[model samples]
Structure formats: structure tokens, C-alpha cells
Target: MDTHTGRRRTDTDAADRPADPAFERRLLAQVERLIAERGSVLAAQGRSLADLGDVEEFAERMVAALPTRHPYDESLGPFYDTAGLVTWLGVSRQAVADRVRRGTLLACRTADGHLLYPSLQFGRDGQVRPGVFEAVGEFTRRGVDGWAVALWLTTASEAFEGHSAVDFLVLHRSSAAAVQRVVEVATADAQSWVA
Candidate 1:
């Protein structure tokens, strides 16, 4: 209500809306870069834009194929801070830090210098799965960063018969050798690119 004018106020003014030109510009730039990159990769593989059949389908696939990276400041998260982890694992904050230091847990540091642990490492029983730590150790040994390791654990890989490393781990909890194979194969491919 507009008490000063003695009249009821309604949301009819367009000027009340906030401007978002910066966000729009950033989104436009990212989309343009993705399209250009995807086009080049497709061309290299003998699959032209025409082979996509439809523009919308191609856009969908391109989005799906986009690499998953850590968004440092955004609220969209499956991440847990120290306090949350303490509660979740029924352990002290120091214990969490110790686990991270020992490479028994996977953690990503945010721009604010806070460590955020990926929720995927915990099972339904609130315990860190055994294979996750082993995979993290292997990734660390092969020079993979924590973010890439987290993404590799979650993302579907052809090496695992189209199943993600985490999925295979959950399905075959006792088979550490299978997870080791996936890690070795991925690490070797990454190294070959470096060579």
C-alpha cells in the first residue's frame, strides 16, 4: 500500500525490475564458446552439424556433453562443509580434516577458502565408501586434481561399459580391482594426451 499517496500499490511498473545485462552477456559468451568448440570436435570426428538431424536435439546433446566443473560461489550444491560433515558422519571437525589430509576423503576448496566435500562419497549409511578413497588415492598418484576426480567418479565413462565409476563401485563394492582398472585406463589416456 502507498501510504504517502493514500492509494493501494500494485506491481505494474516495469522500472521496478532489476537489470541483468552482465548475466546475459556472460551466458551468451559461454553458449557461443560451447557451440564453437563442439562444432570443431564434431567436424574432426567426421560428424558435421547436419548429422545432428535437428537444431534442438543438437543443442540438448551439446549441453549434456558439457564438462562439469566446480562452481565456487553458486548455491547449487551437493557439497558439505565441515560442520555438516561432522553432523553427517558423527565425527569431529578435526577428524574430517584429518581424513582429508590423509587422502581418505575427497574435498574441493572454494574461492572463500572453505573446504567442500562432495556428497557422493557417503553411502546411505553415512559412511565413506571404501572404493572412493582408493580411487582418490589413485587419481592423486596420477596427477588428477580433486575436481576432475570428483567429476570422473560421477560422470559416465565408456571404459566402465557406459557406467560411472561411482555406479560400478556401488554395484560391486567388494571388487576393488574393477575400480582400479577404470582408474588405470583413465589415467593412461590422460597421460597419453600429455605425451
Candidate 2:
């Protein structure tokens, strides 16, 4: 038979039901105790469910943590020149020597009249590039080492018609040193050849 609560009577109902009112009260008390001892059962679900509800909270806390843009230091690197350092600096053949005399720029001349300067020390504006303080935090956070970077400035054959180190910037600092040494040797050789 169906009771007013809509529960169906079964053969075991009489046996399963607590005979004493106190026993029924005790069972109810135990259930209430369990509910109190544990947290809301929904809290025990997977992290994904928690994450879905926490998205707005997480965004509120972390929206400012994301960066807005990349700085210019991320784009600068070691660049090279062709047709000698004089031509690269847009100066006459004698201008590099003049700068050397004036103590404005450093230049090591080769025997064949070729001059080499440290291109990395100068920026596109003929002035030293600023240090990376503005973007150093982001650059360091992303683990970028500017030493290994290179920017190749190309020149047409007509501009540098018969140059040796055209269209390539040897980025490796050690490689630049090696090239400078070669220029030193060539300067000595040229001095000897002229003598």
C-alpha cells in the first residue's frame, strides 16, 4: 500500500522500520551528526567544478598580472656592416679615421684600408642604445639573453659593390672578437705591404 508520504510498503518494511520511537530518533540524530561533521558534499567534487565557479574570482585577482605589451629591447641585437665601418656609418673613407682621431668612435684599420668598429655599441640613431631597464623585468622573466641575438642589415651590391662582410652580422660576441683580431692582422699586413 502507498502511504500518504508516497512511500511504498514492502514485505521487509515492518522489519526494517525501527520498532522503538527512540531507535528512530537515534538514527535521525546520527544522520544529522554526519552532516555536521563533514562539509558540503559538493565541495568534494573534482577541481574542474571548483575552477568553473572560481573563474571570476581568479580573474579579479590576476587580471593585472598579465602584461600589456613587449618592449623595444626585445627587438634589438648585434648587427654588422659591409664596405668597412666607414661606409656603414655613412661617412667618407677618411671620416672613420677622423672619428678615431677625435676620440668619438673606436676603429681598427686593416692593411687593405678596411676599417672595423664595434657595431653593437651604436644604435640606429648613431647614439648608444639605452639600457634594458624599462623592459628588463619582462625580458628576464621570459628568459631572453640579448647576447645571442643578431640583426642583419643588408646592403645592395651597388652600395657595397665588392664587400666581404656584406648582409651579415656575426652575433656571437666571441665571433666579433675573432673578426677584430683578423682586422688587426690585416692592418699589420697592410702596413708591411706598403713598406
Candidate 3:
């Protein structure tokens, strides 16, 4: 019931009150028509909203549509280069060149081209003890992300056994200090994920 209009209104009409039914219907019809028209246009262009099922496809399309060097297309953090680092570290390479290229790790090549990293530098190329990797792998198996593993290893001051070598650094050091080193290396190894 509309007090001002002094007429009974349907529930749907009342829900859309203050809006004329004819106008509302026309507006909705127009919107639907527009959607259909646009959908057809997109289909003609070999694309459609229907094809975008999961977020991955949508994101892929968005990325594919991006022009070169767009800031939005770039990764924003230190761990962005983790894949390469993990590979190099696994291969027993010093990985200084890789880290330097990423610009997130810091080190100087010695006269003989040997890389020098401070003992406390987390991302610096160092031998990953077997137990350390096991500890990290345990954390990962338990659904821990890199941040959590790094946090526990660097902050908790506890020895862990896992398949990822990250735990070794944490086991031998206080978590706080280890975390600090991780931060330093992240900054120094910019874009280098290996460290």
C-alpha cells in the first residue's frame, strides 16, 4: 500500500517503489537488451563472458590484453623470483649472478670471481644442510607458505627437519635475527627469488 499514491502495490512494485513500473520495466528491458547486444558483439570478436569460467582464465585474458611494461603486469615483491632461486640453489650453484640480475640480493664478486656474502645474509649462496630442507618440507606439507616457514625458521629459534633447506638457517639462529636476514636478502636480491 502506498500512502501518498493511495493505491495498493504488489510486493515487487513496493520493493521498487518511488520508481514507475513502466519506466522500471523499460529500464530493465533496456539493460537486458544491452547485455545481449554486447554479449553478441563480444562473441563476434571471438570472446564471451561465458568463456571466462574460472578466475584464472579471466586473469589470463586480462594479462594477455596488457601492453608491454605495464606496472600492473609486473610482480611487486621480493619472492617474485623464487622459482629461479630455488632451481639455482638446488643445483648447488653460488647463484650470485642470478641474484644480482634480480637486484634483490647483495654480494660482491671477489677478485677470483668468488661471491662473498655475509654470514648473516639469508639469501646469500650457502650450503643448505639436508635437515634444513626436510624441516621446510614438513612445514610445506603441513600447509605452510613460504612466509610462515621463513617466520618460524627465522623467529622461533627451533631446529626443524624438512625437505626444504630454509629450516637450517632458522635452526642455527634466533627467529628474529633470521627474519631480519631474510628481509635484508629480500631487499638486496630484488626480483631474485633464489636467495
Best candidate (score: TM-score):
1
- For candidate 2, what is the lDDT? 0.36
Model 2, position 187: C-alpha lDDT score: 40
Per-residue alpha-carbon lDDT of candidate 1 for residues 13-64, written as tens digits (9 for 90 to 100): 3344576899879988998997779789999998976876787644543332
Q: Give the TM-score of candidate 3.
A: 0.23
Each prediction's Cα lDDT score? 0.64, 0.36, 0.40
Instruction: Give the distance in Å from residue 106's predicted Cα in candidate 1 to where it truly belongs.
Output: 0.6
Instruction: Please state the error at residue 182 of candidate 3 in Å.
Output: 19
How should the candidates be ordered by lDDT, best one leading? 1, 3, 2
For candidate 2, what is the TM-score? 0.23
Quote the positional error of residue 95 for candidate 2 in Å. 1.6
Models 1 onward score TM values of 0.52, 0.23, 0.23
Per-residue lDDT of candidate 3, residues 20-102 (tens digit): 78987997798679767978999999999677467554444333221221121122112212222333344323454554444
How far in Å is the alpha carbon of 107 misplaced in model 1?
A: 0.4
Better of 1 and 2 by TM-score: 1
Give the CA lDDT, 0 to 100, for residue 94 in model 3: 41
- Candidate closer to the true structure by lDDT (higher is better), 1 or 3: 1
